[model samples]
Target: MLPSNTLPNPAILARPRRRRSPMTLGAAFGLVLALVGGGAWLATRTPIVNLGNEQQLSDSGLLQAWKDGAVIVMIRHAERCDAAPGPCLAEPDGITVAGSQAAQRVGQGLHELGLNGADLLSSPKLRTRQTAHFILGQALASADWLGTCDPQFPAEAMAHKRPGHNLVLVTHNGCIDHFARQQHVPGGERASGYASALFVSLDGSGKARILGRLNEPDWQRVLASSGR
Candidate 1:
């Protein structure tokens, strides 16, 4: 045996190195990619409006609020032409027959609340105009501000509000979503469905506040509750 103080041969003392498996590395890489992809999807997802349980407004309450000239109603146009996929520029896209019927029902609901005291405006889009006409039973004023998803549209609508008259805006989902974001309306509010109404209240200082949303189904509920 070598003396205890003597160094051993380097070759004999060296230990075998461990190698990582390609499968293990691949799994780790895939996991990382999945995590990144999921995060990106979450970031881009449409936010859901968080209207609390107590936020649901009764038909009478909403009607009274509108009569008081304290409400600004913004509704998305009904379903557009669905004959084919993708955008069609041949003619102005109009609402479907079902959508027309839905618009009529929406108009009936509003009429039950008395629309004579309301001023109506619509996006220049053919779909929106059709919806407005069906709902109000008359032609409405078209405004460029309502036609696009401009951040300033909400404020413009507020400015157009006349005393003793509620402002009714018939527009698209994108415009309403943009307006909600601009107003910093907090909630997990999902995309408003076709003909859904977003009711906003304006203060004496002309500040807009989102009161709540009334979906298409909710309108029926309100009508039933009011026995109308």
Candidate 2:
């Protein structure tokens, strides 16, 4: 059986829960976050917040987590070449030119956050590798678990997190969502856009906590509000 996702804290899910009225099979399945563990794959749980909102970002404690070096940010790769009809970067499996530029912008956001004690990682696939390269101006260490997007994803992610050093992983939506579900993100907080980020932390207590999400275009606002 898949691991159950914990209920999100009241502040994040402060709103009242609605009674289930109806649902399509597809919609029902969408609520489940996928994970691969022990050579097997399964789905996991909650609600996530939009740190894109300036006020939300300021209140999210994300900056404090970064200051403490207890942060792991999962960035979904920028627009894939094959996903759109627009021009491709270099290969069909790679990202578009715009995607690369977006990656650079996101890098700047991370730069604003500081990277002195940080590690960069990416999925081994061409798209993810390319995304990480554009972000850091060089190739990042690639790993199978990063690309595998399996149920073991949560464990693998936690395993890669080093103390006193923030970590960044460039991966796919499914992988990112898996981690989100593990946190029990509400079904509504699921669209992790191209180059979007899901922020999380694992401190001394060894508990992984969700911080917030940052869509690609919200960098400017977040930076201004965060004062980082």
Candidate 3:
């Protein structure tokens, strides 16, 4: 404690208190983004958008892309039997019974989206095959690469994507993750859940546009909101 104001220094009294500069909006935003998901916001590639809500989906241009037959929809197979407690749909290697029901619902949603000109395919794995059957109401062509989860997945997807038709692929989680990675999705981001779908548009000549992702249960909400 200084001598109780015995004689305050005139210089001290005349000195102004220094004020700290407030953080800039950009800096604050960068900080927040970093804390939550690193530099994904600043990344040049488009970040994976979650179309779980009405606002996001409505503005995502997903419907128009679907109508134009320029989208490739990747769907992760539903719950696996060995990993899930539920009874298997048929074999221990296949998806669970409940998963089949979920797959059915997803299929209905795609049907509502009008699969008339859509090309549906699945991985050769048992789980994916079973899921594809449930979603498509029949067995479809099995592509070995769908189960490969290769580094060339992005190219393969574009190669399979028809110029005038939507391509619906029922595959594995790793395969979906690989696709998301190609979209520049951060590894810290959450993986696609069972029966979840990621929509990508081949709008550009060479660059693929990442439309958005839709979870299994949000199909009804997305469809209901689109009013298409």
> lDDT (CA) for every model shown?
0.75, 0.86, 0.87
lDDT tens digits, residue span 53-167, model 3: 8888878998888889999999999999999998988889999999999999898889888898899889999999999999889998989889999888878888998898999
User: Which residue window of length 10 is worst by lDDT in model 1?
Assistant: 46-55
Rank the candidate models, highest TM-score first: 3, 2, 1
TM-score of each: 0.69, 0.78, 0.81
lDDT of 2 by residue, 138-228 (tens): 9888999999998789889999889989999999998987887778775567668999999998979779989889998998767967677
Task: Give lDDT for model 2.
Answer: 0.86
lDDT of 1 at 44: 57
lDDT of 3 at 208: 84
Judge candidate 3 against the unseen true structure and give its global Cα lDDT, from 0 to 1.
0.87
Worst 10 residues of 3 by lDDT: 38-47
Each candidate's number of clashing pairs is 8, 14, 0
Model 1, TM vs. native: 0.69
Q: 61, model 3: CA deviation in Å?
A: 0.4
- Sorted by lDDT (best first), the order is 3, 2, 1
Q: Judged by TM-score, which candidate is best? A: 3
Instruction: Give candidates' CA RMSD values in order.
Output: 8.2, 18.1, 5.9
